[model samples]
Every structure is written in structure tokens, then in C-alpha cells.
Target: MPAPRLVPDLVPDLVLDLALTVRHDGKGGIADDLDGVDGLARWVAARGDELAEAGAPLGDFVADEDALTAVRALRQAVRTLFARAVRPAPPSPADAQRLLPGAEALDRLAAAAARVPVAPRLTWPESAAPEITYVPTASGPPADLLLAALARAATLFLASDDRTRLRACHAPRCVRYFLKEHPRQEWCKPSCGNRARVARHHDRHRVESAL
Candidate 1:
């Protein structure tokens, strides 16, 4: 079984899922799912349907070292922006001093997004409301197209009201950002919440024993 996640995998935003690729391993260490080209390919494959639905198809896509590098860089920017969005609240430990400055992150995201020029297409079904979708208007390498799509997703998420719901998980060893799904929601998941409570209990016990 997969380890519990602070954020659900079904989040509508790809960038959030991308940012969560870096998470706390169950054994008390940071784990990166996209630590290599193969890992990146796997991650892409897992999200193929969602990416296609979002207007970036990756049919038979294979990731190279360059693609890994590009996606890693974009992930850094997205994570940094996520940290910023949860301002006043502490950011994930993963971002401590490694995050890009806000301005630099913004520039990087914009550059990646501009790599592929896209045009909006309208679609409406008989009983469904009309939706505007952006599709690439220029040819580019699969990596470039994927990067642009991720950057655009990040851009849209940052501009949406959902951004206000972003929060970094504060449970020990957790380095995830989750959307605040409820007014009483604290940690990213129940396990994190339990860990936090247990930690607090231990601290109080220690303090009482010391006194």
C-alpha cells in the first residue's frame, strides 16, 4: 500500500501534485519521486490522462536527463511559490534556504510557460456548460510542451481563489502543501494530525516531568 499523503492525489491542479512529489519517506527521510529520468517518466505516465485532459498530451512520452532537469527546475519554482502563498504560515521544511526568490521564481515560470505558444479552444456539450481550453499552437519537443503546460497550470492555480486555501503541513518530517478543505482542518492528513498531537503530548509530559 502507498504511504498516506497529506494531500490527496485527486487535486484538480497538476502543480500541487507536482509539488507533492517531494515528500517525507515513512522512515523519517525526504523522498523524491522524480529523482531520476526514469522516475520522471513514471510520474508522467501516471498522470497521462490528467495531462491530456488539461490540454497537454504525452502519448508515448519518454523523459531524458534534460527533461528531468527542466521538470526539477520547474518544480522548484512551483514549490517556492507555494511556500510564498502560505505566507505568515511557515513553509514546508523542504523549501528552507533552497527556494528561489519570488521574483526569480516568477520569471522562471513565465519563461517555461512561454516555451510553447498556446491558443484557447472552446468546447460545449449538449447538456454541459462551455469550457475554454488552451492548446499548443506551435510545435515543440515533448519536454518543452510538458514544461509549458505545468507552468501554465501553476500560473492558473496561483491566480485562482484556491490559492488562498493552500497550507504547508507542519507535522514533524512532513514537507507537503495541502488545500485547506475544511474550517477545522489542521495537518495534511489524519496521520499527520495524530503525529502532531502525540508530539505535543510528549512535550507536555517531558515538561511536567522536568518541573
Candidate 2:
């Protein structure tokens, strides 16, 4: 059988998309899509237009070790926030504090969040009439812009009612997180759902044989 492609679906929100970067395989192994500087670059490139629409473009990405490190740290922080928020209990003050460790980080995120423009404006496509579009106004190194975009996404996600629907895939070898668009949706994708069902079937057979 062919391997399944890990295509990025157009998630309802950016924060949920970011959380999908690091996934746990149902079999106890973990995979980080943004593993290093190159990985980070690729991830950004893949989402270039999306980020641009959100007012953060990757045209100035540094692709250095330091930049990669910063991005990874921020990714982990965002993941931490999501993990805690989705728990049955409400997130505590300490939980929120962990996301914004120091004054500097907090300021950076705040600044980035502030950079998002108020509204999308009209733009004319070649040979077409003007259409409303979000032109990126945020400026800085790519990493900074990326972080700011992430910060903004995190803020919006945590503040919205839809945050309650954020869920991590329950399949044993799957590590993806997804927004539960429908009440019955369980896994990140159909493959994960099939894998989970197969595992359950095997377990049931094993128990029956033992009995």
C-alpha cells in the first residue's frame, strides 16, 4: 500500500494548524514537522500565502539555527497552551503564564499581535475587477513576523468559543490535532480513523481468543 500524504488541510484557524506540526504516532513515537531550520523554512514556505493573508509573510526568513530555535520554542509554547486549554478543567493562571515566560516574550507576542491590520482591502487582479484581500502589513525579520502571526492566532483561538472543539487524535499511532468540525469526528483524518478501528478489532479478537 502507498503511504498516506500529510497534506495540510485548510484548518478553521491558524493556531490549530500550528499545533498539527508536532504529532504523536499512535505507536508511541513522536514526529515534529518543524524539526530544524530547513524544516521550519519548508513549513513556512508551504504556508506562505496563508501567512501572508494573515499579515505575516516569510519573504525575510533568516533560516539560521537561532531563528529555528526561537520558532521551535514558540511552537512548543503554543502547543502547551492548546494542550492545557482542551483539558476538561479550565486552564489555570500558571498554565497561561507558561506560554508567556518572560516580559520580553510577552512583549514580542504583544507587538506581533498588534501588527495585524484591522481589515482586508480591495485589490485588482490582472484582467479582473477589484476584489477584497488581506495585504500583509507586518514588517520585521521572517521569524519575528511568524511569531507575531502565531501569537495573534493563539490569542484569537483561546478567546473564541470554538477552542472547546479542539481535539488531539485518539488513534494509537496518530499524533495530529484537529478541530472537531462535527460532533462525531474523532481523528485528524480518515486514515487515522481507519487505523483506530482496525486496532480495536484486533484487540477484540485477541480478547475473545483468550476467553
Q: Cα deviation in Å at residue 111, candidate 2?
A: 7.8
User: What would the per-residue lDDT of candidate 1 be over residues 111-164, giving only the tens digit for each residue?
Assistant: 999998988777778997665677789877888888988888888778767789
- What is the C-alpha lDDT profile of model 2 across 97-172, one tens digit per residue? 4455445444554665564443456666798755543444645666666776677666555555666887767675
Model 1 CA deviation exceeding 4 Å by range: 1-12
TM-score of each predicted structure versus truth? 0.92, 0.70
Pairs in steric clash, model 2: 24-175, 25-173, 26-172, 26-173, 26-174, 27-173
> Candidate 1, after superposition: displacement of residue 107 in Å?
0.7
**Cα lDDT, all candidates:** 0.85, 0.64
Clash tally for model 1: 0
TM-score of 1: 0.92
lDDT value for model 1: 0.85
Q: After superposition, how far is residue 88 of candidate 2 from its true place, in Å?
A: 2.5
